[model samples]
Target chain A: MSWSFSIGSISGIRIRIHLTFALFFIWIGAAFWNEGGMAAMANGLAYILLLFLCVVLHEFGHILTARRFGSQTLDVVLLPIGGVARMKCIPEKPGQELAVALAGPGVNLVIAAVLFILLGSQTIMQDVAQPAKNVSLLSQLAVANIALAVFNLVPAFPMDGGRALRACLSYRMDRAAATKLATRIGHILAFGFGLFGFVSGYPLLMLVALFVFMGASAENNSTQLHQLARRLRVSDAMITQFSTLPVTSRIADAVALLIHSTQHDIPIVDGVGKPIGLLTRARLLRALHDLGADGQVADVMRTDVPTVSDRAELEDALRLMDEENFPAVMVADQRGHLIGMVTLENLDQMLLLARLQPRE
Target chain B: MSWSFSIGSISGIRIRIHLTFALFFIWIGAAFWNEGGMAAMANGLAYILLLFLCVVLHEFGHILTARRFGSQTLDVVLLPIGGVARMKCIPEKPGQELAVALAGPGVNLVIAAVLFILLGSQTIMQDVAQPAKNVSLLSQLAVANIALAVFNLVPAFPMDGGRALRACLSYRMDRAAATKLATRIGHILAFGFGLFGFVSGYPLLMLVALFVFMGASAENNSTQLHQLARRLRVSDAMITQFSTLPVTSRIADAVALLIHSTQHDIPIVDGVGKPIGLLTRARLLRALHDLGADGQVADVMRTDVPTVSDRAELEDALRLMDEENFPAVMVADQRGHLIGMVTLENLDQMLLLARLQPRE
Candidate 1:
């Protein structure tokens, strides 16, 4: 996502391309230029471009299916390996996920079938074993689409088949347990691929194996984190002993508090003991730079600081913090009095601890 | 980052490889085996592996420099195109960014120089023009490293040289302005590369041109967004008109409220008019699914719902919501009474409006 640039928006979704994907085009062009000159370069580029177009459509299948389940697709990025449709979040419901995963390969299957019908099945089959350079574009594309569908159907993590497998398994067990079992199977399959690649001296298969191995564990970890988040409460993670300031305090007071204590975000309370503002370290630093340390805390404190009740779900709390882009959230009691705070720094600590602690 | 798995941690930074990178090795292995057999395959693989090691070191150069500037390197992912060091954020200061950008190419220059010296200047120079297969490993690597350094130094968005150029430009102008100018120049350069690639029948260069062209505008858009965020406040964008429910209300009442009103988050207030909890549509739906409509709003409402001051910076509010991972943040007045709310849905609409509105 970092190195990606959007080429355009399609059907309300941004279509992005990673900088590296250019290398595939370049490499193929250079290879063809050296082998068969300008005409060959044109032919090769066109064929590959067509193939990439198919990849886009394949990704669109997944995107459309995901949209049906109410998931938003943020961007569709083309990498050298394949196109990745990044959704805001995947459907947690197994049936929805299963449909989304299958949709991609199904598109490819449809493309292959259509091409087969157009080009004649026997000719397409005969040309399937031939290299792209030696075969007709239609026949080559038909075979490539079939290969794409079959390759993606491999029961490996991060692949469509792996997700479908997990979805099916989830119907019979806990989501987390299903994920763990599916990931394990993915790893085993990856190991097989790696063994075969190494034995056959095919680095490509080994690379795929490595990808599968990594993807399986990564998905497992993410799902577990999500599960953990769902079970947590803001009260379980909020910091209760943090320092606070009255609205009448000067900026100098906040600077003094910073020196004497570890607190960076000091809540400002009203006469009624309600938190009226948050004096963040960044704001304090900027106020000091522009208005001097003698500036009133009231002038520097952010009045629109995000707050949460102690009983808020940790996931919801995290979601709020993420949405507001705030560094900390003040925790309030049922009386609407500030009781504690939740900061990203402390949330990370809580996550680390959660990882170490056993699941309930 | 979602699909990424850490192969290992080095110096507290995770090192990862994309699944497709293994394709490079596979390609080389197959190509070499077909050309010269096992010995050639071994030689080719070793050379390429060592080349990739140099790329890793190149990325480390950027990482170490960025770390010095207080930017955390989240992970280093190797793709077949090159290694990318994904930092939490680039340095805000121009000078620091310049140094970080140059550090990567500097590493490659050092590697090239060292290898050039080790292989002897004359021999290395002679072999530089030869194909990779015909040259000694050290000689080829020396040339390759030099090529890497030079290639990376070409001013292109998301590339090290382009960043350095922008950093230099930023010294004389606003960061957002500098980024826009730099991006425009990058697009021009990309156009040149594309034209040249087409003329020479080199699709690779065309691909690189496309990447550069897109990357420039993407970076420009992101920087502009950050700049816009710095200038706005939550009060400017929050939803002021929202319905509220008394804590004494039942879940059935909230359900009826939802059917008639567009508001999704129904804030629940206490007897004294202080906001106590939030009955989000999601929470209400889940409650209805499990507990039936007879549940009281007081029992179903999320007391930990995040709230924000009406006067906070929009960026800070966004950051808080993001960190808390909440969809919305309640806006409270100085009296600790909920007056408005900020939802991601509305925030996106505001962003779209901001994009269309001219800046001061």
Candidate 2:
């Protein structure tokens, strides 16, 4: 996000520009100007920008279809290689995934067809085959689209082609199994691309290969996490037995506990035992350093907390934790009272257990 | 990690090879065989393998220096691009960082020096210039080493050159300010490189630009988080007045609470007001689906919890949570009691507040 900025939006989805993506245009302009003066630079910039627009349209094709299946794409980011649609959640159904995956390349194919008609196939082919002369902008655009379509259809992980393959395989096996197979295929394809690029000294192909390879691995891990989420519950991994502090205690009291107790975070409660705030060990030292140990517990304790019922699923808890980027959540009972806590460690244990004994 | 396998270990640092990295050789062998026959194939593979070994050695130059400064490196992974040392915690001291940053390039420089002496400058240049034929493997190696050193010295994020620049800048300004300046310079440099790559049609330069740009942003965020961790405590953001559940509660009771309470995770406590376990919201629904609402809370709640003293630093708590991979951790007071909770949501508010009021 730091390297990208919002360009605009399509409906609710924001279209963003990666900083380097914009730089690519400026780079093209500067380099072309150095080589062939202003006219060539202008032509080059125009050509690059048009190609980018086509890539954006291709991403939209995927984004729009995904939206129909309740997948919300937050951003469409433009990079040199292609446009990436950042969808936080993808539809799980294989049928829907197949449609979503195919939509992008499908758009490119249509664009190529339309451009070919507009430019005339004979003239377009003539322009496409030549690099120095008789090249129409239309033909170049058509060729770019066609290349995008063909390249995307190579069938590998991290690509539309790979997703389509996974979707098809999912019909015969489980989603995870299908994804694993697809990811392997993607790796092989990426290796092929990278090897070809290295020997031929083509950086573009090498970068593509890296992306495909990394994507395959990352996708597999994400799918595995999803499966774990579905099969587990918060109760399966919540931690019990921790220390607490009274609301009347001062920073000195908390510090004393920090030295004596292994606990680095203490929950503070009122006289009647209703929770009021939490004081972490770091806060304790910080307070001692800044406010002195005399600082009242009420003044230093954190009071903004969220509690969850202990009967919840680990999946929802994991989602909540991810969104919060926090390590722990408190658990509550039917009477709306704090009873336990769930930490990232607990979740890891549960995940490990589930992985080891999936049927359990 | 799924796409990488450990070949062995040096001291404690594991040497891992990315799957594609190994496949690159196979790809070279097959591609070369098709294009130039056995002699060419053998020569090509030998050249690539030797280059990768240099890269690995360059990485060792970094890892050894970092280890001396107490930064633990778990893996040194080889890829076609280069070698990556996965250092968990980088040394923060400006001098240490500078040393760690320069070591890899320094090693490359040394290798170049030694190779120059071995191959003789005249022969090396001839071999490096005409890579297609009349190439001495030794001369090719010297050129590769020199190129590596030169490329890595380009001041940018995600690269050692940028780190070195930042380290130098840190002496004149605050660490945060220095990083910001360095990042901007890195971005501009990345843009320049990318432009040059595009114009000259060099894919390697373009990928390096992308890595630099992204690394700058990621590094800045990480540094800011570290700063925040030092200045803030769990108390600054711990949520208070949250709901809790009693140990005696049943799944049906939790169901009642779930419908009425906004809390998703419920902490369960004993009669004397001591925490026993935590149940998450997802677990509530899952338990209902799997075990019915009549199931006992004692049987389903998570009990393996870790507690921290309320006086502990938020940084420590954050580390604990990260290691635990949990959503929440219980806060304990002097009496070893769970008085409050800190959830990921609370941490977010704290982080947001800290960012807004850095001085505070």
Best by TM-score: 2
Please provide, for model 1 over B1-360, each residue's C-alpha lDDT reduced to its tens digit, 9 standing for 90 to 100: 255456898899888877767765697788888889999989989988999999999999999999998888778998767888877767979989999999999999999888877878999978877886688999888888889999999888668889999999999999998998889889888999986765565544665787788878767866775677678777766776557888999767776565433456788988776788888877886676566667788888888867778888878877666555676778888998877777766665444334433431
Residues forming the 10-long window of minimal summed lDDT in candidate 1 chain A: A351-360
Model 2 lDDT tens row, A47-114: 89898888988999999899899887778998766889988678779999999999999999999999
Residue-by-residue lDDT tens digits, candidate 1, A164-244: 999999999999889999999999999999878655655457657887899798778767756776887878767765668
Whole-model Cα lDDT of every candidate shown, in order:
0.79, 0.76
Identify the leading candidate in terms of lDDT.
Answer: 1
In lDDT terms, how accurate is model 1? 0.79
Q: Candidate 1 chain B: worst 10 consecutive residues by lDDT?
A: B351-360
